[model samples]
Target: MKVLYLGDLVGRSGREAAIKRLPELRERLKADFVVVNGENAAGGFGITPAICDDLFAAGTDVIVTGNHVWDNRDILPHFQRENRLLRPANFPEGAPGRGIGVYDVPGGRRIAVAQVMGRIFMDAMDCPFRAVDKALAAYPLGRTVQFTLVDVHAEATSEKMAMGHHLDGRATMVVGTHTHAPTADHQIFSGGTAYMSDIGMCGDYDSVIGMQKAEPIRRFIHKTPGARFAPADGEATVCGVFVESDDKTGLATRIDPVRVGPRLAETMPEVV
Candidate 1:
């Protein structure tokens, strides 16, 4: 099974890049399933239902979100009807949307995808470790599902790495998001799970974490709120991770970083 997991999409540039390139990416990478982080797909805030529709139409099988999931009030009602869009499972019970979903792939196979947020340097939430354990208990890999993906949408790399180690043998891949900068630590754990601290954001990297540089810079220097932050409108580089797992064992056999577009050196996995 081949799964492609994209990082967080920030604003118009990132959203357009992902929507425009997803079809070609699916074809070129031979991805059987695709998951994307759309937490910041709006104007550098939360995503809306319209953006979700656009992504779905473009080939995204599932969309995951983080703390910014609630930035857009318009998405709250849509969650009741959309199972493919997920918020962190660690959110308090009765949260608008679920954090985990199991979907059917071709050939009668199944894949489970879940997102969990870390508490370190983040909003207070339920224990991510416990939340993940509870979610994965129902879907045993190689038995109940052929592939499982966990997105650790977090600010701290340590928390993300811990999640990967904790779910080492249980999931097919454990990739991180929310940091908006790709880490160079793509590797398969001893237990067969592919792990990467972060896959980076799908937006212009020239600014401060995809936002326009001026406001953030001024705030950093003046220590006072000024203009609101906005997404950089420059050309974006679509970033993500590609994982190919063993069909029988439901473990990752190959993992590679994928970065396409300007500003970032191009790297893609061989399509074998």
Candidate 2:
């Protein structure tokens, strides 16, 4: 099974780039499943039902979110209606949406996706490790599902790496998001699980973590609240990770970084 996981989408630029590029990306990468982090899709705060629909129509199989998942009050009810949109599984019980989803693939295969937010330097939440373990327990890789993916939407790389190691061998790929900066540590673990500290954001890299540079710069320099942080409207660089896994073992065989657009070195896996 081949899967492509894109990191957080910051704002209009990020989401628009994703919508424009996803179809061709799926075809060129031959991805069987696609998961995109849409936490910051709505004006760099939270996502909405309309943005979710646009992403879904553009070929996203599932959309995962992080701390900002609740930033938009309008999305609270939509969560119950759309299982494809996920908040962190570690969120307290009674949260609006689920943290995991299992979907059927075209060739009679199945793929399970789960998202967990880390506690380090972020909001307090349930134990992410336990949450993921409980989620994966029902769908054993290679037997019940042909592919499994876990998105560790976190602030600290250490936390994300720990989650990857924790789920090694059991999942096809374990990737991180929320950092908005791509890490160069894309590699398959000894247990055959693909891991990347962070896949990066699908937004402009010219600003401070996809936000307009001026306001963030002002806050840092003046140490006072200024204008709101807005998404950089420049051309965005679509960033993600691509993994191909073994059908029988449901483990990654190859992993590669996918970066497209301006303000970054362009890299795409060879289709063949």
Candidate 3:
């Protein structure tokens, strides 16, 4: 199974860049499943139903989120019925949306996707390690599911790395999100799972982690509340990880990064 997991989409530019580039990417990479982190798609806060629909229309099979999943308020109710959209699975049992989703990929293969937000430097939540463990246990790879992917939406790199190592050999890929900055540590663990500290954001890299520069800079320098942070509207970058998993064992066979757009040096994965 070939899967492409993209980083977070910040705002309009991110959303537009994703919508514009995803379909071609899927074809270019020959990706069988696509998962994108749309947590910060709404003006850099939360996602909405309309935006979710747009992302799906643009070729996203599953959309995962983090702490900002509920920022748009409307997404709460919408999330309850949307199977493609997922929140952190460890959110107190009765959360609006589920954290794991099972979807049929091409060739009639089924894949499960789970998202868990880390507690370190992030909002309090259930143990992400435990949450993912339970999810994977139920959807055992090479048995109940052909492929399993985990998106660790987190703030701290250590926590994300821990999750990757914790789920190694169990999931097809363990990719990180929420940091909005892509890391260079893309590798396949000895356990056979593909991992990346972060896939980065699909927004402009010229700002403070996707937010407009002036406000975040002002707050840091003046130490006073100036205004709300806004998404940078410059040329955007589409960044993420690409993994190809073995069909029989459901473990990663190859792992690489996919980056495009104006903000970053363009490079498409050598998918062949």
Candidate 4:
């Protein structure tokens, strides 16, 4: 199975760029399933139902989120009704949406997507390890299912890496989100899991992680909030990781990075 897991979409520029580029990307890459992190899709914080619908119309099969999942307040009800939109599973009992979702891919294949937020440097949440274990236990690979993707929405790279190792061989791909900066550690583990520290944000590269640089700079240098946060107005890029998995075991056979549009260089994987 060929899966394209995109980084977080931030702000209008990011959303527009994704909606503009995703169709061509899907065709060029021949992706079977597409999962995009939409936590920051609505003006760089939290996703709205409208944005989620736009993403679906633009070819996204599953949408995952993190801490900013509930930023809009309006999305709370949508989270309850939507099957494709997922929030961090470890949030808390009675949290709006589920963390894991099982959906059909193009070839009538079942793909399960799970999102778990890490506790380190993030809001207090249930144990990610336990949450993931429980979610995976419900859908064991190679027997009942074929493909599984885990979006570890986290801040600390160490914790994300630990989660990746913990789920090695159990999932088809284990990709990290949050931090908004793409990492260069894309690799397929010996255990057959495709992993990346952070897929980064699909937004302007000139800004500070998708937001206008001035505010973050001000907060860093002056230690005060002067204005509301806004998405950077610059050329946007769609960044993330791509993985191809085995049909029988649902283990990753190939893994690569994707960076397209302005500011970031474009490159494709040269399968060996």
TM-score winner among the candidates?
1
Model 3, stretches more than 4 Å misplaced? none
Ranking of all candidate structures by their lDDT, best first: 1, 2, 3, 4
List pairs with backbone clashes in candidate 3: none
Candidate 4 lDDT for residue 265: 80
TM-score of each: 0.99, 0.99, 0.98, 0.97
**Backbone collisions counted per model:** 0, 0, 0, 0
Model 1, residue pairs in steric clash: none
- Sliding window of 10 residues with minimal summed lDDT for model 2: 1-10
Question: Can you give the lDDT of residue 66 in candidate 2?
Answer: 94
RMSD of each: 0.6, 0.7, 0.9, 1.3
Q: Higher lDDT: candidate 3 or 4? A: 3
Off by over 4 Å in 2: none
Candidate of highest lDDT: 1
Cα lDDT, model 2, residue 141:
97
User: Per-residue alpha-carbon lDDT of model 1 for 1-272, expressed as tens digits?
Assistant: 99998899999999999999999999999999999999999999999999999999999999999999999999999999999999999999989989899999998999999999999999999999999999999999999999999999888999999999999999999999999999999999999999999999999999999999999999999999888899999999999999999888999999999999999999999987
The digit string of per-residue lDDT tens for model 3 on 78-103 reads: 98788999999999888897889999
- Candidate 3's TM-score: 0.98
Clashes of 3: 0
Check candidate 4 and list the clashing pairs: none
